[model samples]
Target chain A: MTGSASGLESPAEDLLKVQDLLVHFPVKVPLIQRLISREKVVVHAVDGVSFSLKRGEILGLVGESGCGKTTVGRTIVRLLEPTSGRIIFEGRDISHLSQSKLRPLRRRMQIIFQDPHASLNPAMTIGRAIGHPLQIHGIVRDAEEVRQSVLDIMREVGLTPEDQLFDKYPGDLSGGQKQRAVIARAMILEPRLLVVDEGVAMLDMSVRAKVLELILNLKRRHGLTYLFITHDLATAKFLCDRIAIMYLGRVVELGPAASIYAEPKHPYTQALLQVIPTPDPDKRRKKILPRGEVPDAIHPPAGCRFHPRCQSVLPTCGWEGRDFIDLLDEHLSTSPKGVEDDELLGSIGEWWAEGFEAGRKTDAKDPKKLVERVKEILAKAPPAMAQAVQSVEAKGEFVIVQFRTPDKLVHTAVADRTVECLLYQ
Target chain B: MKAKHSDPKRASSLPEIPLPFLGRLIHPLIRERRSLAGALSWMGLGILFFFIFIAVFAPLLVPFSQTQPFASPVLQAPSLQHLMGTDNVGRDVLSRVIWGARTSLEIMAIGVLIALAVGFPVGLLSGYVGGKIDRLLVLIMDSIYAFPGLLLAALIAAVIGRGVFNIGIAITVIYIPLYFRVTRSQTLSVREEPYVEAARALGAKSHTVMFSYIAHSAIIAIPVIFSLSSADAILTAAGLSYLGLGLEVDTPGDWGRDLSDAQSFIGVGIWWMSVFPGLMIVILTVGLSFLGEGLNDIINPILRKERS
Candidate 1:
């Protein structure tokens, strides 16, 4: 443990440690599903991932979407219970502590999430959400003092006129504002180390930069250490002091962030860098779409997980027959940014929003007639909007309204942030 | 090993700007889903509520305030005086129908509350703490579920001596397993959600973890289970009354007794006596199912629809 309270020379060595962590999920078949159940298997989401950070040092953990980066972040904060691991914070292992024992220590370790919306409780106002950690840690008992503390944390996250944002629900806040609320909640603890798991990925590109700047500024001001888990090598480079690239369930490379990006050693690390969308159009030609789809976690390949699809394949690379088709499929899927989803979701949200707004403004003369008219308006909307609106209308009608679609596979990495594939080999 | 200076001034733990939602004493329930314009999804729910309105606020709706008809002949057929006709006791079937709403509905609702009130905390503690506690709770619930619910309800009814409250208590005991299973499964899933972890990271106690993060997630399961158990509750209560072991035989406003009493008169072909009470039960069950399902879907879409 490098980051203890007694006194170290720099913020970079205050201490963050994870010892031999493991998390395995059980997948079982119902009696009817037995024939196809094949065999009971465990999806080892995280296997023996261990690393540490100093008081203010940023330890960048980079990997593809399912490479367990987020799981590792959650586990360190004990958000996801480790099958067997030790999380040492400020030189004390909190692993396996009873909930009672963990309570006081909780204020010392906090986390920021990828989806600001999902991470926040929608029913709570942003200020309450931020002040929650303060209350839980018993930082302020007096009502007046809690309010002042919340406003100050809000300012640190860059929300203006702190009073204005104090009353907004997570639903009302914009992407950046929601992210700031999450940060405010985590920071209220004045935690020594913050686990930020792709915290800015959900924001718009323009807003993302501002949020990232706010984060870096907070780090400087508080001397807060960070365990920044991301798939984006570029963000990792910008935010981390040191970087560790995970593949399958293990770190394949570890070094200073600049060196790992500038001079990657592992084949997975090299491939990830080569795929970065280079600004110099000439340099763009070198983009290497990763060769294989991320294996279904429940049934991963044997021996060196990336070997099956590696162009740098060798007898030692763990190449297998299924790897070829998987590689071809990957090449096909990455030809161009697949159809942009922003436009579709935006159009649908807009249509539903308009319909609901109109529904509210409709004269009270007859709700039935208003509903019928709303239905007609929805039928005439654009295709995506029409579907979204229809669903919204049926909402509270046939069933409670829900618009959950399949969680699409996203290229979560921004620039040279990932360390999967084999181009850097 | 190394350490860093603890700088109190730089804690900069203060907000950079304002936070809007702070200082609220309570969390507001998100009024996210509006119901079918409250039009009443099923014909049964409408009819059930109509009858209830007549029973509770009878003077307002019905032209005649008398719930107890003064002069109706035994086994009488349908007429203006006795819309559903008279039972063997010579009481108005329609009055009984209106009054029966209070009895059956109270049983269903109270039984469910019992299941939730008694079973929820047990299920939560079992799943979250796990180990010996989980096994002990599981053993008790598994034994309860092992009994055929109706027979189990009958046994409890028999033991408690066939009264209205006895029948409901019996039903509540019989159905505790369903609530236990539903709640335990939900807690198992919710305890793993990220926010629960986030809450724990903030030093939230187990009680807070149980009620705060997991409860809402667990609550979505409530409507679905309520819908499910309401169906069970209605059927079991009706079954017991029909069997002569539920709701004391001489009790007024008994739908089960109405049905059972309707049995011997069948030869005379006065079917509306049995048909109306049976229909009332169907409506209440179906209405509850639809409303509960509708609520669940709005609150937690993923549960309503699972994808590959």
Candidate 2:
């Protein structure tokens, strides 16, 4: 399967390179500027995401919903423009190319959509729709050649009795037939790169496996580069050689599919593995129950993004100033907003002072030194708008923030397999 | 992707039924009492076709020279000498009616045809290439749709000063927006379809995708709209004659003018004067409406899928 990658990674034969890509969608309210100005909150849908495909590597991006897996796939193909990123395809900077400039490139990259029924035009006969690409790319001159090419591709996709189906409209085909017609259309141009966005997600379970096999077969037959995006890791394991696990708009785990699945590094990956239903219940194992719903993208948790849900959270997890405020906000069960109602803000200030005082006790050996540190923190006035300070220090050792942020992505850690969790540290 | 070896026999048996899908697609027309409306349509159209055939060959069919005036009795009423009862001018009433069919259908078909030719392309372009082009076409068409179709046609006739072509060109101007609007909407939805995207991926130019993929969906709706528009055109032509803006008042030979003048005689209880022309309008409109419905029934998506 990876023999195709040799052509892709070779500088002369490279197909596409995606580097540190970020696609932030600014949630806009129609006709209301004052209501939400630099109030312009950005959903880090795909943040600092980086990956590259050698000529034929099948890179599977696996994640749950809102993981930005789909965004990465689309941005790399230039289907959707990246907010800030570089998409180098065969040595050309295609990231911001205009529609006209992108025309020729489109002939080399194709996408097979999820909804088979919605993909093919109901008014067009299979032959016209399939032959459409051949004529558009100017690959075929004669009308007869175009028809013959469509028939050949239709057969390749396992559409048996292709001649009989030629004159039929998409509305006539069943789910499987429609999907095959779509592949027939895609393969007509023999694109170098194919983005299959959960391409088989919509099919019945029985149909899903067969479709996946067809894609595998096509890869061998055509030497195609596939960026298979799916929330199903199991499918990724089945189809991809190397899999990247995405979380909160970033890749937190990636490595060889066989290696990662057997020795999963990311706690999120482990939790996901446990959830896959086993047909044989007798073989079921204890599932890891990660806490909390996925946080709002607009204002994510400060430390590790997964801190709130990670069972093994470290206090040192990306706990910066934002993490402090988030914990105070969590404690009050209220957000601090008004300067006039400075009471909540004051309490948040005191909370931080108390947190520092506790840290002093743990670091200091002498009781007198600990007391001096607490006095110093209390003596200083709280910052403006940050009015008062809350004090609840027992033995005075640690401040408890609500959650922790996982420090690194999956591949960055040098474990035998790429896993994204503090436990590896 | 292959069907199972023992896939339910009931699913396979579905082809025997007329495909329940056909019923769903045509269900709206049935509910609209369109199927019944079709009866009035076909019966009327058959008469119109017969009338047109006779009118085209009036001299040959009727065996009478319209200009050979007063060769027979000056006035005759329902005798072997004449079928419908002759006028004071001594012309056969049947021959005039037969001759009149030419003017009646000619104006109607020509006016509608002109509207479709211009409106279809405008609608197709406006819809597929949305944004400035679409907005501009939509605004212009909407303006025409906003104007009352009859009043607009009348104004165009008056301005042109006089001619059958003027009436047709005017009616087309007012109703092109209808075709434009329908075509644009169909294009919008069709463009979003995967097949269109597939075409784009395959490197199809904007024009190829627009015409090859999007325009065909809009074609289905044209028959229904065109038939109805022609009905309106027929009435418009008649109104122009009523206003003395059509076919010239000196030529009392036109159906609309004949109907308009007969209205003055309505007070004298001359029912035949108003009745004949009124029936002509009703017959033509019914004919077009039935044909439209029949087309809809035949091409209805449900039925189309069933046969496929």
- Identify the candidate with maximal DockQ: 2
**lDDT digits (tens) for residues B184-224 of candidate 2:** 77667666766666566566788887777676656766766
What is the lDDT for A151 in model 2? 93
Report the Cα interface RMSD of each model, rounded to 1 decimal: 3.8, 4.4
Off by over 4 Å in 2: A1-13, A25-28, A32-38, A41-44, A295-304, A314-411, A416-425, B1-82, B86-92, B249-253, B290-308
Worst 10 residues of 1 chain B by lDDT: B20-29
lDDT of each: 0.68, 0.68
Where model 1 places Cα greater than 4 Å from the true spot, the runs are A1-13, A17-52, A64-68, A79-87, A94-99, A122-125, A141-148, A159-173, A245-272, A282-425, B1-45, B58-98, B125-143, B224-228, B266-308
Alpha carbon lDDT of residue A222, candidate 2? 87
Docking class of 2: acceptable
Put down candidate 2 lDDT per residue, A1-21, tens digits, no spaces. Answer: 256445445645557778888
TM-score of 1: 0.66
Using TM-score as the measure, the top candidate is: 2
lDDT of model 1 at position A40: 69
Model 2 alpha-carbon miss at residue B201, Å: 1.9
